[model samples]
Target: MKQAQIICPVCEIKISTLELPQGKNAHCPRCDTQLYRGSHKPLRDNLFLALTGLLFLIPCLFFPFVTIRLFNINFSANLVSGSYALMKESSVILGFIVLFCSVLTPLIVFGTVITAHWGLTRQHFTIFKYSLLIFQRLKHWMMLDVFLLGIAIAFFKLSEYATITPKMGLACIFLTQIVTIFLLSRLSVSRYWQRWQSSEQFQFDDVQTHCHHCHLSQPESQSCVRCGFIIHKRKPNSIQKTWAFLITAAILILPANLLYISIFYSNGKRYEDTIFSGVISFVKSGMPEIAFIIFVASIAVPIAKIIGLIYILIGIQFKHVTDYTRRMKIYLFVKWIGKWSILDLYVIAITIALVDRDQILDFLPGPAAIAFAGVVILTMLAAESLDPRLIWDDSASNTPQKESLHEK
Candidate 1:
């Protein structure tokens, strides 16, 4: 069976998304933008994978995750312990962020995906329609992978001062993270959307109105039947909203780097670490790899995201815009890498969770931690708010090439 899509999501060019070689993907012949991936697996496999990931998350939440023994005082912590500790210390917002990003968010992503695939298998199109939309938007919020990486970083940082042992919950979390990633790879919106599309016969005005959620074309001024999103040629006020978020993040990022990021009281003496000092310490201790990662995520990513966004915005608005492909690539990269900046917060949360606070030593999130977290969140929001399609729209230098399937 040959399934087809009406228009290219990136360039908004009217094209056919059919007849790709197995194991290869269909890229837009004009701009080299990938349209959809070819999948040999059935929708049932996706359903099972989503269900398996959800099953693993159960043990990951409650079972003992790590045990740390410092000075003969043994303390155990689970996945939720970080949130509890933060809440007890009066960081209500940070507490909720950790708990929701680690647990509730993943649950929503996995549960919605399971429902969507299940609905597809049972021919209950209505169920999958809305469920799929929910999964698409919230899928990136599943920071379970980043949280697990935090555990590894915490283990390395604490191993010198304490005896750290991985427990059953760690294994469950690893499996859940891997399974969730695989499930996402297979759950292609365009592939599923093609199945729901009744006919390949193109309708007038359909090619002009493209739905970002479903990646399908429909008439103007109407709701997308598959996803129920109100059709807009481009996201409404994308540039203005994105600029507001970017400006706020840019302003906060300076203080976030300059101020102490983490603070602890050891034997009644205060020790504070700034972002640069922490990176320098890591390098001084011969863990340059970890140092580099922190520097990139904490420092480089935010700056790059802001610059990339600014360049794209300026490129689109200029009278003579060139290198549309380059602009689109930048946009995609910025959007994809924005979430990794939260890794720093995860490290702090898990590190604090591992050490039980006492008279001898107490850990607290420094004022800078909140500022840095704001930058991460605001950059993510900024990326999501901008419509990449705007880079190609209304550009005189570039025109849509003839319709063809260029396999990649």
Candidate 2:
């Protein structure tokens, strides 16, 4: 029997699927776009990690994440308190966004993954399929990694004026991030889907066209049969759309840095600070690690992302296809870290919520917070708009390969 095949979503080239060796990935021979990766570990192992991460989340919610003492006054915050504080302070939308991304989404993702794994083990096909679908949707919203970076920024900012201490919940959050990353790396959903299909003796039709969004196989059509999203060989004007978002983000990064992020008031003194000021404060306070993180996430990452997107867009526009693999890796890295740029805004939200008193000590949100959030969101959209398969399309012809490796 002929092996199954999938068309590259970005390049629209039909390629045979390969059963990747353990810890290996099959890239398109022409464009070097990663088609699929093999998981070195079993699905059960990923299940365990997901469960472990879920357990760690308990401490992250209840226990103190950080403590700050200023002028003999001490205040501690947990994950829940920040959201509640923001809501209480009338920033309802911001509050919900923080809570959903930091707490609710992570819980949902792990829960869904756990359910899917259980269904897989028990051969509950319906439960497994639906659970996996939900998991795929929730995974993008789980921002614990971004939340942890926010915590680091909060610590650095607080340390500059108060006696700051990392609490047990903070440690737990870090560990949860580690386990989540590990679980995601080991659990290849595509591979598991293929396995389930094999066990069920389900076969996809030999169709040249497939939906990029839903992965639905169908005859050549203009829209996805399942999703109703307009189907295209590649994203419509992918390069132009990416460039627009990237340029917009690049333009916003300046005011995001130059304008004040937050203003602090204490004992009749006022201090307004930008992102760089916070980094400098941390460094001067002997917390070089915190400074480095803030600098990278706030400064380096955003600039690097804009520049990286520009490089990729330029390469695609001009048909300069050298180092396709390296550029693809860069694109992946940019996509992965794009959300972390929101850490500074998150820190401000949490801090504003915590330190809002009349006289003693208080912080006010600044104009830059909105600008910074815009930068993060725009870059994320840019990453989503730019298809990685386009990187390969520049060098390779549109012909579909017939004799590609088969998925096992």
Candidate 3:
């Protein structure tokens, strides 16, 4: 293979490609950010995997995800019903967000992946372009893995009260998650571009500018020639938008954790649980493991995200450019863990769907669910609004006058 020129999205360090064995990625020498990893699998294999995952995921909505049995009462819940149940319990916004994150995003991503591969197979670059772009933009929002974890936590928490059994839908979703994650891990933007170039002369290698959305290097233009997403040196209005989101999230985090998040009724006795109280309940019930998970997801992650984001923002504002590696790690960690914070919402959605207003046992969404949802969403938006490249840019120069958010 011939050497190719590539620019690191983080530091803009132009690097010459080197031949590396399969399964290893080339990293930026300056910031250690991954720059390239060639996918070994053919597009056909990815197409088949995506199709398999979609087929499994579709049936998951119709079939029972889990069954609950308690004294003349039996009920089942699946993805669709869980969202509906959440909406009926007055947490409509949170319910819709959960539905979007778990169901719609994954479906679109997989569908796009298959179509993109189909386009590539047919040499239809137009179809390939749009589908691949959509896949790139939406893949991060897919939370099937977190949804699966929520399933386990819900089962453990509810087992103390009722007989809970996994159903075929659960099995299907599990397989879907595994397949999707594996496919995503193997999927890399550069591999497709290389494949395209091999078929014909392509301009990808000549350009040094990188698309953050797709991570594809192309000739500098208003939009990415490959993915069609708008291109920029760094995310537009990165710092200002991040601070706005973080401040809003910081305000909501307090109410989100302190107020009641869920209500349960068992044989005419009403019980309510806040984020902390719920975790404590799990510990009291001899499930400290589950308690810890809940604490981390529902309580710790949200706060940590806010504080971490604030730390990054303050560092940038003060031009604290030292510890580039530490700041970069904080940025990536915040982004990676932000979505997992929504795990509790899924648990609540599933539990309320399965046991909501059942006379024998029931669950209801409390006021805090919405607040908590806001906390999660805002923090995620905050993380996304931040440009990781900003850390490197700050390290290179502390020039405050260039590229001001106010300058247009």
lDDT of 1 by residue, 1-408 (tens): 255446677677777555667788777776677676766677678778888988999887788789988878888888898888888874878788888889898888888877887777788877878888888888878898888878877787777778988899999999999998898877887667667664354445334566777776666557876567788777899999999999999999998999998887777778899988989988998899889988998899999999999888888778336788888889889988888888888888887787656657767788898899899999889989998788887666335434768876
* Cα lDDT, model 1, residue 295: 92
TM for every model, in the order presented, reads 0.93, 0.80, 0.91
> lDDT score of model 2?
0.75
Per-residue lDDT tens digits of candidate 2, residues 1-408?
A: 135677765556677665556666666555455566655566777778888998999888889878777677777888888778767764665577678878888888888888887887788877777777777666766788888777766765666568887789888988988988887666666656655553124355666776654464556788855445677867788888888898898889999999988788887688888999988887888889988888998899999999999888888778885777678878989988887787776787668755776566887767787678778878988988887877877655667665473343
Please report the candidate that would top TM-score against the real structure: 1
Mark the regions of model 1 whose C-alpha exceeds 4 Å error after superposition: 1-5, 121-126, 197-206, 225-227, 397-401
Off by over 4 Å in 2: 1-25, 30-34, 40-42, 70-73, 115-130, 137-141, 199-207, 210-232, 236-244, 286-289, 314-327, 402-408
Model 3 has an lDDT value of 0.81
User: Which consecutive 10 residues in model 1 have the weakest lDDT in total?
Assistant: 198-207
Q: Assess candidate 1 and give its TM-score to the true structure.
A: 0.93
Among residues 3 or more apart in sequence or in different chains, the pairs in candidate 3 whose N, CA or C atoms overlap within 3 Å are: none
Ranking by TM-score: 1, 3, 2
RMSD, one per candidate, in order = 2.2, 4.1, 5.2
TM-score of 3: 0.91
Per-residue lDDT over 132-204 for candidate 3, one digit per residue giving the tens place of the 0 to 100 score: 7788778889998999999999899888778997899999999999999888987876667656654124446
